[model samples]
Target: MKIALLSYSTKPRGGVVHTLALAEALAAAGEDVTVWTLGRGGDSGFFRPVDPAVRQEIVPFPDVRGEAVGPRILRSIDTLRAAFDPAGYDVVHAQDCISANAVSRCVRTVHHVDHFTTPELIACHERAIREPFAHVCVSAAVADELRQGWGIRADVIPNGVDSQRFELAAQDVPGLSRWRSRLGRYVLSVGGIEPRKGTLDLLEAFALLRKSEPEMRLVIAGGETLFDYRDYRTRFDARAAELGVEPVVLGPVHHDELPTLVAAASVFAFPSNKEGFGLAAMEALAAGVPVVTRDLPVLREVFGTVARFATEPAGFAAQLRAACADPGSRQAAGRDLAAGYSWDRAAARHVVLYRGLLG
Candidate 1:
């Protein structure tokens, strides 16, 4: 069957990552798969190279300087809608709010639900959830949220991690040495200084953690998003200054270098206020790095006993300290958990769902 998977951007956001990986896996399983995404910021392809077997349809979405996010989002919907013809595919799956809103009919994947204040965005989010014929959630907790909030039932399909890639990175002594030489004894966070990412919370946690581990650095990587977080960034910078802590903000690390970066971390901190499945944390786990995540049900469901769970700054600081000092069997347990999430299994489940929908 011909399958079309749509996402808002060609960046390395969790949802986009899920789309690309799922498409490749489906293609590998002898199914015709295509991934459609908006090539934002002069990008002609994904952040990383995709499998040759899966077709790519990157709709040109040039940047508009000084444009408000609301207007830009609406324009993005209009532009993608104009370019994408849904009639050609047997299964049309929309991966995010923008793509879901633009398409006439789709199987929407509610990776994580968000609350929007703007009227247009609120409406768009509502329509995307309500209009989609079928829905998928990466965690059962997210599916439960969909059911409780909108009375919408969704299929729960967890994300698949590239366990081998990160596992190999852990074993790459030279690669690990390079990253460790660059940033020594660092507590790492992936997902930038956005409000949803709980960046200020991380700042506070890092400052507190520094009290004990004075020489440890706070290293943050990856901040590619369609949303403008300048205001939140301003707040984050101010808080970092107030707390007398400086962090190494390496925005958007290269795809090939990311696994090594993950492997080199002393401890991984993911104090996100919200998340779908905590994919970045999982990648760190796969790399044999100890991970501490925000105490969210979805993350709890995904990580189980493999990850240390925390809520606020103090909690996060405490967990990070424990993770760094003594990871124990959690590291091995984490590797096992990460390896269990296979893209092949996820793709086969998707095929079953798609066929069920077609029938």
Candidate 2:
């Protein structure tokens, strides 16, 4: 079967990560697969190298200064739509709003539902959900939302973690030692400083967390997005200064180093207001790191008893403290949970969906 998986950007966002991993897994299962994406900011390929078996088609998208989020989103849709041709592939699947809008008829993976006030984004989100021939969601909670809001029934296929890679990184004494030496004991969060990520809330929690654990630092890494968050970033900077907490903002850490960084962390903090599958937390779990995430139904559905949960900054701080205080038991459970999700299993399920559709 010929399959084309689409994503909006070449960045390390969750959807893009899913696209690449699923493509490779499908290829490994003896299916022909290709990944299509927009190469924003001169990115010629994905943040990390993908397997050679799966082909990549990166449409060059040059940077446009002063482009607002609305216009940028529209342009992203246009650029990918203009470049992509769905006729050659037997199955075309879009992994994000932009890619779903780009193609006329295809399968869509609704990783999560976003409530957008902006006109363009609202329309794009609506069309992406309503027009797809079929839908897949990373978690059942998201699928339930789709059913409640749009009366759409979607198959639930959970995300897959690269468990061995992270588990190996946890065991890599030299790599872990190097990161520990550089960053000290720290709470780490990926996905950049954005409102949706609850960056300010995390700053507040980190500040409170520091009252007791002064030796531990706060480290944030991996932030690449099409939308501009300058205002949120400005507020974050001001709040960090006000709180007198200096967080190590390592923007876009090298992909090769991510596993080690996750492994070396004292705990992984996922304070996002919204999430589809909590992939980063799962990766941290694979590294045997304790995870503390915002208490949300989706998170509870995905993580179950594998992680600590909180609803606010104070609660987040308390959970972080607890995770740091005694991580051994949670670490074992987290590792087991993370190891249970397999990319091969996810791919096999997808292939079944595709064949069912084709029939």
Give one clash count per candidate, in the order shown: 0, 0
Question: 257 in model 2: Cα distance from truth in Å?
Answer: 0.3
| lDDT, candidate 2, 152-241, per-residue tens | 999999999999999999999999999999999999999999988988999999999999999999999988887788999999999899
TM-score of each: 0.99, 0.99
The lDDT of each candidate is: 0.92, 0.94
- Which one is best on lDDT? 2
Poorest 10 consecutive residues of model 1 by lDDT? 323-332
lDDT by residue for model 1 (141-230), tens: 999999999899999988999999999999999999999898999999998889899888989988999999999999999898878899
Those runs of model 1 whose alpha carbons end farther than 4 Å from true positions after fitting are none
Superposition TM-score, candidate 1 onto the true structure? 0.99
Q: Among all windows of ten consecutive residues in candidate 2, which has the lowest summed lDDT?
A: 327-336
Candidate 2 segments whose C-alpha is farther than 4 A from its true place: none
